[model samples]
Target: DAMVIQNPRYQVTQFGKPVTLSCSQTLNHNVMYWYQQKSSQAPKLLFHYYDKDFNNEADTPDNFQSRRPNTSFCFLDIRSPGLGDAAMYLCATSRDVTAQYNEQFFGPGTRLTVL
Candidate 1:
């Protein structure tokens, strides 16, 4: 009965090391998103794939990247796990039916810890 799943709810990585967080949804939605959220801060949109149309937020750092090879799956790859990259990585999904307004359903999130 898992609608959305994220592997390794908590992850630890050394500084400058690469880490990848995964997310999958059973909802079969067409739109998938990745967001980064720090303590007491709003979740910032990193990027999203709207049925293969990749849309990235202008302020997203170059060290952060994401990929959606197919529906129901998405991955966030951190090129370098710096101290600043330690945060909660949240994955969300929404239907592509109505572009005007669509609410996103979030996963449990993977908390990345950089040492």
Candidate 2:
């Protein structure tokens, strides 16, 4: 199954607090990605780990960070979530080798609410 899974489909985070979101995949893919999306807008790539290589999008904020210690799991850390950070956090996975032609699989997403 080429499925990417994210836990806690909904999360309520406080302003200026830290939150971590998790993702796991059964696709055995070599790359995992984190994205931030808001109100039906296009998902913005935050970062991705292609095996041990970490690629961060050029415009990603410093407040966002990520880690992938193993092949199947990855974590997204948002430090001091602001009101602007109140959005859906999407976890995605793709095969590193076929990335040019293959599309990434996305999770159901964790909807973060900052208050």
Candidate 3:
């Protein structure tokens, strides 16, 4: 099946330590997005890659960083994990942006645990 894949469904990291979560897709979509979803709150868009152009949300914290080596893969790098940072990291992909809209497929999120 050609779909988005997130590795290390569960991750445990010490406070202030760096952790990297990876996402890859076989869909070959042009746009890939990363979202941080906490317990009850709405998912927050952290960043995205539209082809080679990188877009980061204005309110995204400095602790969140992302890298896309190519069209099929992206990585979210957390510089310093905190207790408050423990949440589900979701990866999604879309073909292109349009005035009307297009659907994005999301992966089974990676759950991060901070200790």
Candidate 4:
């Protein structure tokens, strides 16, 4: 089945370092999302870009940024990582969340560790 794919499943970075997580989709879905999960807590939606339109969550940190160059690729950039930034970064996709059947497919995620 088609799904979302994230690179560098395990990432270790020093404090204050910059990191970038890559995400790609084989399903060619219209909506792409980025999320952060700390420990056992529920994943928090950071932002998502639909086609060329980008929408960010009201509470998302200013340190985070995203870019979707085309339909198949997206990237999450963390300008400066702090100790609290360590978590599992997830990438997901769906046709449209507002639609009746908004089935989102998630990638395995990239585990980021701040040293």
Candidate 5:
């Protein structure tokens, strides 16, 4: 019954600047996921971690990078913020990849604005 947490609910950055979004969870879930959601569009899976293993979606841009130093925390680092990169970044956790229900807990999300 643990929860996911994201820091700095809102963020603003200048064009070409670097920005990072952070997420943490008390759930100790084995799988952690990062997603990008833009206005009027479904969330797109950027990457995920199963324990210490990192998995990035084939279409995920090189500008986006993630790090999970430990089980409870994950970070999304944007190397260069672009106008089109402004969106809601989400963090989710699940017990494991092969769970029967594959239920997940999601954070409130960090809204990034590129100026």
Candidate 6:
């Protein structure tokens, strides 16, 4: 099936360490998004790629960064992992979320543990 997939369902990182989470999709959607979810909190949008254009949310911290080398792959890089940074990283894709009729489809997500 054409769907989004995230690798290393679980991840562990030390304080100040750098970690990278990956996502890939067969859906061939034009928009790819990354979101962070903490316990008891709604998922926050970090960034997204609409084709080759990258859009990062204003509230996204400097510690979070992303890369989309191509349409099928996207990567989230944490420059410095903090204890508070532990959370689930979700990867999603959509044809066009802004359109009146478009919607999003998400991956299972990567759970990060700061140690």
Model 6: per-residue Cα lDDT at residue 7? 92
lDDT of each: 0.90, 0.90, 0.94, 0.94, 0.94, 0.94
Q: What lDDT does candidate 5 reach at residue 13?
A: 97
Q: Residue by residue across 6-109, what tens digits does model 3's lDDT show?
A: 99899999999999999999998899999999996898999999998999999989999999999999999999998999999999999887634458889999
Worst 10 residues of 1 by lDDT: 94-103
| lDDT (Cα, tens digit) per residue for candidate 6, span 7-98 | 98999999999999999999989899999999858999999999999999998999999999999999999999999899999999998767
TM-scores of the models, in the order given: 0.93, 0.93, 0.95, 0.96, 0.96, 0.95
* RMSD of every prediction: 1.5, 1.4, 1.1, 0.9, 1.0, 1.1
State candidate 4's TM-score: 0.96
Taking all chains together, the TM-score of candidate 6 against the true structure is 0.95
**Candidate 3 segments whose C-alpha is farther than 4 A from its true place:** 99-101
Model 3 worst lDDT run, 10 consecutive residues: 95-104
- The 10-residue segment of model 2 with minimum total lDDT is 94-103
Candidate 2 backbone collisions, by pair = none
Where model 4 places Cα greater than 4 Å from the true spot, the runs are none
